[model samples]
Target: MSLRGPGGERSRWRWLRGLRARLALAISVILVAALGTAFVATYRGTGTQVRNQIDEDLRTDAQLVDSRLPLLRAKPGEIAEAAEEYLDERALFPLSARLFMVRIRGAGNISNLPDLSTAEGDPRLDRDVAGPRRESDESRALRTADLGFSTVRVNDEPLRLYFVQVTRGGRAVAEIGVGESAASVARAQSGVARTFLVAGTVTLLAAIALGFAFATRLSRPLRRMAGTAARVSAGDLSQRIGSTGPQDEVRVLADAFDRMLDRLENAFARQRGFVADASHELRTPLTVIRGQLEVLARQTDVTPDDVRHVDEVVRTEVVRMERLVEDLLLLARADEGELVRPAPLDLAPFVTELFDALTLTADRTFELSDVPPGRLLADEDRIAQVVRNLARNAVEHTGPGGLVRLTVRSLGQGRLEFALEDDGPGIPEEQRDRVFDRFHRTDTARARRTGGAGLGLAIARAIVEAHGGRIYADSSPEGGARVAFALPGFRAAGKRAAKEQAAKS
Candidate 1:
């Protein structure tokens, strides 16, 4: 139910557990929440504004009754008879308003809405609010605060009441109450609620559908990547994918995946080559040993010198086999790509010692240049081995008296480039790129003369890469082979050593 994020944290949404589902749900939640909030705010605001308008109309009706009563008191013998005709002569009120009256001279009353309380004793009105009935024209007006405003109901619908009390000689003569219809306020509020419900439902459905489609589209590249990964796991590294959807993170990821596949394909090819070349190289020596042993077993009078010569030959082949096995083991380990542990080493003396040792092993005109004065961080043995292999490779390819130069120089990017340059026929252009490939040789004749299964350059390349450096072959200025490798320079090594020492402390 929980999805893992890029950082490996469990996702917060429990029900919407997948990444796409959560994305869709999140967008939908925001949309629905926004719509619901707007609906409630607008509905409440509309109800409040309409109710205020209705109250204002009720106030105006009460004021009209007050104006009509004063003239009636001066017009006739009784306030009731003249007020009745005056009420009939005028327009009733707006559809929202109704009229109610009480004669203070006696307990008589009339109302446009019969539901109105009369003489303050009508059963429909609350006894506590209505109080005792008015018995005479001298009935004192109710308290000033309670005189003009009240609440009532008719046919179960709520109403607002505003009363105007009339008096003669400062004694109460009559009272008029104006009630306005609050029913329309309820109806307007209902209409708004219904409209919001319908609109919100439709909008929510649309938002959910769009969110699902958007999530699907965004996840398409990821789904394709997953499929490709499954195929890769099943041993098919040749499958490739690129910028599947939009030019975004997914596209960038697809490009990177393709680069990774390229590397995998090359590594796997090297692995296959390693196995095949090892088998072929080992078979020849074993076959020679077996044939020589068989011939010696049939000899009748083998001399001590002959036996010693046979032993020497067998020993030489055994040593060669041992070296081949060791080199293969090293290459196998390199394939795992573990870190290279480098320490501070002086290149000046290191290169001098290396040249002196290599010249002793091969007959060639060796030129040693002054090594630059700076210590670099390198696995001293591995660096020396890489140089030794290149020198040996140069020795094998060049004729007798051929010149070979061992030089050290700066590469301007905190790198020191050490190269073995030979003054012999250089490698052809087509073979340059494959020079570092395992078991690669320009031709079978050269491979046999060199007595190399074509692993020296491959081993050198692997060691160079392990040091976070690069190795390559090029034509020197003298038109001969230039096999070089560059590692991190001395300045960076000192800084790195200092930081490591500080961390330990």
Candidate 2:
């Protein structure tokens, strides 16, 4: 039975696929490859060196046998016996030497190792050399160049052989063979391999452990961020990665993530507040309209005057609701940065027209300060809305016959400032910043009675901001409130226009 899944994939080892595991595994694999390559190279080099040393020893032994054989004074056929006698008497060969032999007369071979070859043949030895071989010793020695080495198996054991000529009285009498077992070379190479294997195993284990630890440390912050994101997706907006320490890439990402959460939280809070304010404002007007209609419906003898009064009340509430809804829509568009489409507007004529129009809105003493001649890049309709909203706000706050002033001047560097001041109860110092907030009223009761939903200043601020300008409230020199806005990218059409703006300022 197979313990495999689809496509023959292993199901039990899936946990090894995580980023940490993969990173550790990759490091370990590279290390193992490096160490394995080194081991193979070292082992092969060690074997080659040891084998070369064995051949050198055999050459030295052959030289010694060549020097001693001439002094023995043995007959041609007794040459092998005479060499064995010398070896036993003097013990000239090292214990590591596996075989010592000399050629006897009649093309026969002798050695310290027994002749294990049969008449049929010995498979362990070379085919030509196996069996009870009887060939010319000179011919057999000529198989290799003089003083050269070769390997052959003797009695089923491998040995390296060196052949050398032995001469007596300037005549070649016989040849001596020096052999050393290949096992000693094998043993030397094995010792080197064993040492490296133990060292490489320990090094690989330590490296893998360090790789895993480093991977875990590096990925810990990312795992925390993932957890935080999951919690945030579940509507826990307060969740934060809160990464601390050195400013690494992970810490930077965590900080950016926390900042994005902050923005989302604030946006959601504002949306909730906006909805609540809109509901409250709409409910009041709806209640008024409904009450007027219900009173009209319950009348037993509804006169024309009573019906007319109810109609007036209902129409008034409807208009107020309509204006509130329109303002809310404009504010919503402003939030999306789609509130304005800009064009070049002649500031002098525009401001004059604005002042003239606002003068007719209330019974206050309306004054226009000096207007500068210049062209401004603005959306004309949005600019008109901003001015109208500010003028109305000022007019409603000031008493009858109070002085309300409008001022326009060049601020230089391609910018212009407009101020609307009223001689009435001034905005409090602390409330200046919040005056432009939606549905914020200094006098809520009075503002409601006067049909002010308190969105005029807020709408004005949005329009001005969409034109790349800013609006702010300050104390007027006339001892009331001053609301001013500044527009950028104001260009003078000519040198004369520039001079006129400069002089006016």
Candidate 3:
């Protein structure tokens, strides 16, 4: 879990689990498919088009040679020379374009250039072209003027040739063949294929590079978060991932982790502080008991007065220790957020009974001045505890001659305010906020003398809050301390009104 742990190593993957690897692979596949499709279409499409153009040119050139050749005036022997001169003038065929001509001299007699037989090139289309291509090209050309069209290789190179029989007035005066080389068509198509291959390869390489970079940028925060989690789980609650990336989903997750860490750190602080405070509070009473008992144990000539004083001192410490333990237990229960069973009660008489109880227990003047008619939904015991705690606080802080008053007033909307005001000096404004903190006491001398652990208001606050209410402190209208709290009221208006009207009757 530490930084030096194996968590830093990249986990193994099945081909594409890594974001970088998946992205690169996906990009490469998509690009290769698309470009490969385009390349195939271009190569085949261009090849077909070029071959078609070659065939058309062969047909056009054969027609031109047929109409322009002067076979009507040329004598039998002069026809070849005239046909060659005419072919050169029209430039219908390039040097690579081979020409073949045949003239019928007499019955069943055909003649052509003696050199066409000597012209050597494609082994297949060599001198044997006129001899062998004769049966196929001539017979077909005899029936149709521009019918001699065929694609064949000459000397292993592609060539296009056609045979044309020159005529005058529909009667054959001479026969000729014209052809053109088609090697350039194959070359052009091959060049296109090579270009596609090179382009596709370069594109795939570039896609790999870009895909890896994008995946890293996206997964970077997640990697960092995983590492942070490992460290945190290893007991490093202080570890935090600061907001470092753009305001994306990953950044949002990091922010949430930071908030959780803040809570964890605060919780740990409170736990440690609770332990330290408990130890300090318990040590004081234990030390007093130990010291008093030790002294009693050592004194052999102790009088009844000395023994009584020691016994009383030890007993007092034990009583205070018991009270401290009970308060701590209550706070612990409250901290656990335990729910209280709630029931309805009339507020006016509830205040009256607690007021009567306080009058019997304390010397201060106690009054239930104004008990407004209302009902509140609360745990009856817990509410009584809160009232008693506040009442005790008011009595303890004030002298014998000082006054204490308890009042409950309806605030409408299922709420009532209960307050205890004392004639003693009120809590300071700065200390008001922390007054309910556990073990916080302002009057150290009084705490030591009367054994008050300063948990009365804290416990009261806990009980009130658990009942879906709030408790706070402020100055009273009577110029003394006022500890007040609010609870949900369950007073029935109809019942109270009926009782009031009955009393009138």
Candidate that scores best on TM-score: 2
lDDT of 2 by residue, 352-406 (tens): 9888988888898999988877789999988888888878878877879988898
Q: Could you estimate the TM-score for every candidate? A: 0.72, 0.84, 0.74
| lDDT leader | 2
Task: Decide which is better by TM-score, 2 or 3.
Answer: 2
Identify the runs in model 3 with alpha carbons over 4 angstroms from their true place: 1-17, 65-186, 299-315, 443-451, 495-505
Model 3 C-alpha lDDT per residue in residues 69-172, reported as the tens digit of each score = 56466654455455546645655544234544543343122223343332222344332244454454423332233436666654676656666556665666
Q: Each prediction's Cα lDDT score?
A: 0.73, 0.77, 0.72
> Higher lDDT: candidate 2 or 3?
2
The TM-score of candidate 2 is 0.84
The runs of at least 3 residues in candidate 1 whose Cα sits more than 4 Å from the true structure, single-residue gaps closed, are 1-16, 71-78, 90-96, 103-108, 113-150, 167-173, 283-313, 332-380, 398-424, 444-449, 462-505
Total clashes for model 3: 14
What is the per-residue lDDT of model 1 for residues 41-114, given as tens digits with 9 covering 90 to 100?
Answer: 98888888888887788777666666666553342236555556555665754434654454434534545433
Ranking by lDDT: 2, 1, 3
Itemize residue pairs with steric clashes in candidate 2.
Answer: none
Consecutive 10-residue window with the lowest summed lDDT within model 1: 136-145
